[model samples]
Target: MEIQYLGHSAFKIKINNTLLITDPFLSDDPDLGIKFPKIEARIVTVSHNHHDHNGVAAVSGNPFIIRTPGEYEVSGINIFGYATFHDEKEGKERGRNTIYLIEGEKMNVCHLGDLGHVLENELVEMLGEVDVLLIPVGGTYTLDAVKATEVVRQIEPKIVIPMHYFHPKFKFKLNPVENFVKEMGVGVPEKTDKLKLSKDKLPQETKLVIMEAS
Candidate 1:
């Protein structure tokens, strides 16, 4: 499968003939201008109802969108959506969000959209082992660096991709990507514009892959 970073928490994953996009924030990010290419997909998975995560209208073609929390199977992909609170204090204000686990072609991909806090034991158990983890590391709207690192430890994914941080286009007051990278002291990170991975190419140890927005 190939993964392309589309700024903020958006990611396009291509597996075989299936193209899945997560939390597509395709517009002028409020803080940053157009940082990534404006592209459409065959399927769009939204984690929550937030503006950044639910910008499905920006994408053309009117792809099949899975927004609510549930399990679904489409085009050989097994998708599991779990309901969770979007705040650290556990639903104190923001209410619930959906955490998605997509299984396809021997690979398990997890996207924690605007995940604001740590995962509970049940959630972790339900997630199982993930091959790739697309997570939010920016503080204001999601888990900060420290909390993100802890989430990684619990999930034990083979690959971790950080997102939702500050960029030149985003006009928010969130911290930069460096904050998350610096906190991952022992994580071996590779900077790239895109990434392609298969079941055989899965890393043995957890790796932090930083992709340029676009």
Candidate 2:
């Protein structure tokens, strides 16, 4: 599998012969002024109704989109969407959010879209074991660094990729990636513009990878 960060919470994942994109925040991002390159995908997944996570216009005209809550299968990929709240409490303000679990290539990838706070027990149980977890660490609209770390511990994914934080172009009040990386306090985190992975080469332990937005 190969992964490319498209800025903000958007990511492109290539698993087997399929391309899966999540939370496409291209074109609409005011800070970066970055326009997304035209790309084709077999499937596109949007976690919620937020503009950052649901840039339907960024996708090619012919791609298949999964937006509602349910189980769907297409081109050998199995996707399960569970309804969850975006804010800390119930949908008092931010309204509903969907967490997606995609199964394919002998791995399960989870994208926590604009997750505002810690998850509940039942939501955690539904997620099960995540091989690759794409999470939001930007606090204003999602979990802060401290809270994100706790979520990572609960999910226990083999690979954790932080997203939704402040960038050069993102106009938000949230802290930058430094906060999260500083808290990690381990070896130097691998910083790359893109990531390539395969089911046969899955890492044994949870690894935090930081990728540059394209």
Query: Model 1: runs farther than 4 Å from truth?
Result: 28-32
TM-score per candidate: 0.94, 0.93
- Candidate 1 lDDT over residue span 96-131, tens digit each: 789899998899999998889899888899899899
Summed backbone clashes in each candidate are 7, 3
* Model 2 Cα shift for residue 194 (angstroms): 2.2
**Model 1's TM-score against the true structure:** 0.94
**Residue pairs clashing, model 1:** 30-171, 31-169, 31-170, 31-171, 32-169, 32-170, 33-169
Task: Please provide, for model 2 over 45-81, each residue's C-alpha lDDT reduced to its tens digit, 9 standing for 90 to 100.
Answer: 9988876677777888577899878999988899999
Give the C-alpha miss distance for residue 210 in model 2, angstroms: 0.1
